[model samples]
Target: MAHTSPAAAPGAFVAASDVAALAAGAAVFGTGGGGAVHTSQVVAEQALQEHGPVPLVTVDDLGPDDLVMLMSGIGAPTVGIEMLSSRHQIDLLVREAQIAAGRPITTLMAAEIGGSNGVGPVGWAARLGLKLLDADGMGRAFPSAAMVSMNVAELPCDFAILSDVVGNVSVIKTIDLHWLERHARALTVASGSICLGAHYPMTAETARGAVVEGTVSAAIRVGHALLSAADPVQAVAAELNGAILLTGKITDLDRRTEDGFARGSVTIAGTGADRGRLQRLELQNENLVVLEDGEVLVSVPDNVTIIDAETGQAISTEMLRYGQRVAVLAWACDPIWRTPRGLELAGPAAFGYDLDYVPFKEINR
Candidate 1:
C-alpha cells in the first residue's frame, strides 16, 4: 500500500501534532534498527513542546540554490539509554556542518525515517532555526550509512560534522560514501559508542531528485493508524503493505555487544496460529534476517520488525528478552533498495547472509 494519502496531508511539512505519532510509527518501520525511541521521544517531545511546531519544507519549497543535509543519531541502542545527547550538542553539530558549507544550510533531513533518528531531526531543525525537510534518505532503517537512497543517486556525503555529548567533535571530508561510513563508524565507537551527526549536504535541486519524499508524513500516518486501531501491529503491517509473519514468544535470545553493535539472534517459540514452530532472527544493531524451521524467510532490504504482541509496540534489538510475547512482521523495502546498487549496499549478502535476496513481491508471486 502507499505509505500515505496526499489529500489527508499535513501541509508541506510534518506538523508538531505529528511528532509523537511519528516516533511510535517509526519504531515499527525501524524494524529493530536505528536507536530506541523512548529516550529520543522524550527529547523530541520536549523540543516540540517548547518550539511549538518546527517548519516542514517540501522539496518544491526549496530554491535550486538552497542547501540541505542529513542529520541522524548513530550508535548502539543499548548504550544510548544510559547516555542521552544534550539538545545543545545536536544543535552544535548542525551549526558546524552549516558553517563548513560556507553558506546557509536550508533544511535538515533524516538519514532514515525509522526509530529515534527519524524524529530527531524535527527538533534539531526548530532549535537551529532551519526548515526540516519532509524528505529522507532511507525509507526505513539500515545498519550502514552508505545504504541511503542519496548514495544510490550518486550524491556524495560532501562533508560531515559529528559530535558527542562529552565535547568531542570531528569533521570529515571523504572521497567515497563507503569510506565515509567506515570512518564515521570508527568515530562513533570512539565517541562512547553513540553520537549525532550530519552529512550528505546537497542542493535543494539534488534533494528533489535524490531523497525519498513525504516519508516523515508517511511515518506519522502509519503511527496514527496503529494508535487508533484495536490491533495496532496488524493495522500497521497491512497499512504499510507488510504481513504478520509469526506470533510467538521469544524463547531464546543469544546476543552480544560487539564492535559498538548489538549483534546476535533471537529464537521464538511459535504460538497461536503458528503453534509448535520456531522462528529465528539475525541481528546487527537491527533485525537483518528471518528464518522459520531453519529456512530463510526474510532478509535485509525486506524489513523484519518484532513488535510486542499485546501492545503493538516495536521492540528494539536491545530490548528483546527470553520470554517476551511478540509478533514478527515483514514489509517490502523501498523500490530503491531492490536495485542492483541498492542490494549491494544492504542486501542479504551485504550483511553476510550468504544468500541472494528475494523481493517480497516476488515471494508473494
Candidate 2:
C-alpha cells in the first residue's frame, strides 16, 4: 500500500503510475456513475504533461479564509461521449466562479467521487495550481449535484458558475438547493446536455464539517487495489469494507431513457453461494436500490455498485444489459447520512420508496 507521509506538503508531485492507481480508486468511489475513468485519465495526463505534476491537498491544509470551490461536469454521461469538452470550458467555469465570489479560488475540490469526476478535478488543479482537496461532496457518485452531503448539510448551493465549450458562461443564483438542481439541469440540457460548472463555495470550516474526508486517497487506494489485485471485487470489498451483495448473470433489464435520465432496473439470477436466489437493482442514472429475494438490502446514499463479475470492473447503469454477469457491492454511507435529517434528505423514502433507511452494516450482519 502506498501512503503519503503526513509531513508532506499539500501540493506534491503525483507520478504517472499513481495517476493510474488513483483513476481505479475513483471508479470504486464513483459508485457506478462518475462517467468513465479513461476520459478523466486522458485529461489529467494531458494537463500533467503540459503543466507538470499535480498536488493532492487535505482539507486541513487549507486556510480558513481561503476560497475553495468545487468543479464538476453535470449532464448525461452517455451524451458526454459525443460532446467532448475543452480545457477553455473548464477555465471559464472556474474564472466565472472567482468573479462571482469576488475572490480568487485558491483551492479546488471534486463535487463527487467517481472515476472521471474525481480525476477531472486534477486537470483543473494542475492547470491552476489549486490544491486538490482529498475530499468530495459525495463519497459515491450521484446524478445530481444537490444529492451531495454538502447539500444535505444545508450548505449554500447557489452561485454556481457554468460554461459550455462554445464560450457561453453564466452564474446561477437560486433560492434553494433543489432549485439549483432544477435550473442547472435545464441549462445543462440546453447547452448540449454537457456543461462544466463550479459551485459549492466553502470556508475550511464548512468543508471540515460536511465533506467526506480522504476521498481522493480512497480513490487512489481503490484504483491501486483494482490494478494490483487478482480479484478486483475482493480488492474493492476490502477497500470499502463492503459486502458482496450478489453475484449472478443479469437475466433481465427494464430500461427507458426519459426526461434526460436513464431509468431502469436489472434482474440477476443467482449463482454460487447465492444460487437459487434472485437479485434486483433499481437505478436512476446512479444505482439507487438493491434487493435480494424481494427485500430491500441497500438504498440511496449507501452505494449500490454493479460490476462485471468476471472482470471485477464496475458496470455503469447506462451499460447495464441482459445476459451480463454482474456482482453487486454494497458499501455504507458517510456516518452523517445515518442521521434523521440526512435520511429525510436522501434516503429511500426521499426517492419515493416506502422503506426506511437501513445501514448496510445492519443488513450485512
Best by TM-score: 1
- lDDT against the true structure, per candidate, is 0.82, 0.78
Worst 10 residues of 2 by lDDT: 1-10
- Give lDDT for model 1: 0.82
Looking at model 2, residue 323 earns an lDDT score of 88
After superposition, the stretches of candidate 2 with alpha carbons farther than 4 Å from their true spots are 1-13
> Of the candidates shown, which would achieve the greatest lDDT relative to the real structure?
1
- For 22-104, candidate 2 gives per-residue lDDT tens digits of 77777767676777777788888788787877667776787866877888988877677678898678777787898888888
Q: Give the worst 10-residue stretch by lDDT in candidate 1.
A: 1-10
